[model samples]
Target: MSDAPKAANPTGADPEANQPGLGDLRVIVANHLKRRLPGRSTMREDVAAGMSIAVGNVPDGMANGFLVGVNPIHGLYATIMGPIVGGALSSTQLMVITTTAAASLTASQPLADMPVEARTGALFVMVVLAGLFQLLFAVLGLARLTRFVSYSVTTGFLTGIAVLLILSQLPTIAGYPVLGANRVMQTLDLMVHIQEVNPAALGLAVMTIALARWLPRTPLRGFGRLVAIIIPSLIVALFHIDGVQLVRDLGEIGRSMPTPDMPSMLRLAPGVLTGALSIAAVVT
Candidate 1:
């Protein structure tokens, strides 16, 4: 065989050389899987998990914002922004430190009367502080301190939170007032007004919760929660239970999207710094 260097393409280009797209990325991933995993299979569970997280946040963010004495839109903004910022700076790959209903409620108690800009400034500060703390922790090699909280303690804490979540949503699910600006007041108020509850609304709420719990296991379960809410809500609407006490409607949905604004630094100062630090502590 003659030793000859391979000829460069005379056209000096390959048609598919720089055509980078999702399919190309997928092909690369498939090749990686073929080499690394060999026989094991995965259905992109991470994609599904991320989607679930995104969808789950919509209702939760709105509800939490309402509970926290802030516009629901802000809660939604926090949900979107928190994840991106947290993901970028956090060393932990699996951390999902978005605003929780309880955390937001706690933090907002102090910041309630503050101006929206001030509150936002506070949130920014808190995120920055939290990021700094995380970095410090990493540098200090104190990440292992998390292990001091025993597994059982962690489990119990999470379990208690789950229980609280189920109990706290009782009013929303039962079509009654959530009561109180804080946890104690809300709980007490619910207890006091337990007698004046609406049956149809309550029934609809229960059905929605049940469907949300069970429907995901079945094939057609994807739309189960929607079906549960819509069907019962429609029935309630058609019946008109009291005529005096009516189901609240948001009314006239809009299709237009809002414009985005650039963020400012000077807007966030001392109060924001304090508030953010407080919030970051509570979060940790």
Candidate 2:
């Protein structure tokens, strides 16, 4: 009763005492939920940041979608849904989830065998299965598996992907038909048809690459990639650069949001499963 402060519930006898039990677990979970919830003061800033990221990522997403043999608008859809869902559920605040070149490239292999009409459905099934696999891995606490992936192996894999990207774009850059059956054959075809390369398209490609490389070093670094894409595009439009291709040349871009559709279960074949696993590995 004196200055001892009643021993501060030392015996843990008080019903209201904080104890390690279901109530404590609830408090822990609530605290985690609170941290994830956006605060009123930062909500506006969060919206602005999300919008900026969405805008900035569109070009890359389109490029990835093109590589995957899908309509480029599908890339934008992937970009939009990925960031929104990923940002909401991820524990890390700064992670940006979006379509990647590696995933697109990997997905193309298994899908290469599918007919033109069936490819889209197959791709959808592959993505859904990949997502389910990822959820399973998370539940199994298998994230540590990535730690075993050697740095050299990763570097080699990325370098190969970069070479593939460059090879795949060669036809577009040179204004040639995408004539090859595989990347190796494509390179051979491009080499044999080197004399037929379109000067205007090649020039644009060179200029875009140069700008993409140099602009990032200047004070306007933040807008480097965007400027690289936009300036060349504007010049192509204004000058009517013949033989240069645009995404619209390929197919009609969907103007509205994509509606969710159920993927065909029959399309989830062994080949698609393999491709989905490959995509998930690269994405992870």
Best by lDDT: 2
Per-residue lDDT value at 195 in model 2? 93
Runs with alpha carbons beyond 4 Å of true place in candidate 1: 1-53, 79-129, 139-141, 163-168, 171-182, 221-284
RMSD list, candidates in order = 12.5, 8.8
- Give the CA lDDT, 0 to 100, for residue 171 in model 1: 67
- TM-score attained by model 1: 0.55
All candidates: TM-score = 0.55, 0.79
> What's the distance in Å from true for residue 93, model 1?
6.7
Q: Rate the local accuracy (lDDT) of all candidates.
A: 0.58, 0.78
lDDT measured at residue 120 in model 1 versus the true structure, 0 to 100: 49
lDDT of 2 by residue, 235-283 (tens): 9889887788888886777778877888777765579988988777778
Q: Candidate 1 on 198-277: residue-level lDDT in tens?
A: 77667766776787677666664444544554666667668866422232232222344334543476665455556555
Clashing pairs in 2: none
Model 2 scores a C-alpha lDDT of 0.78
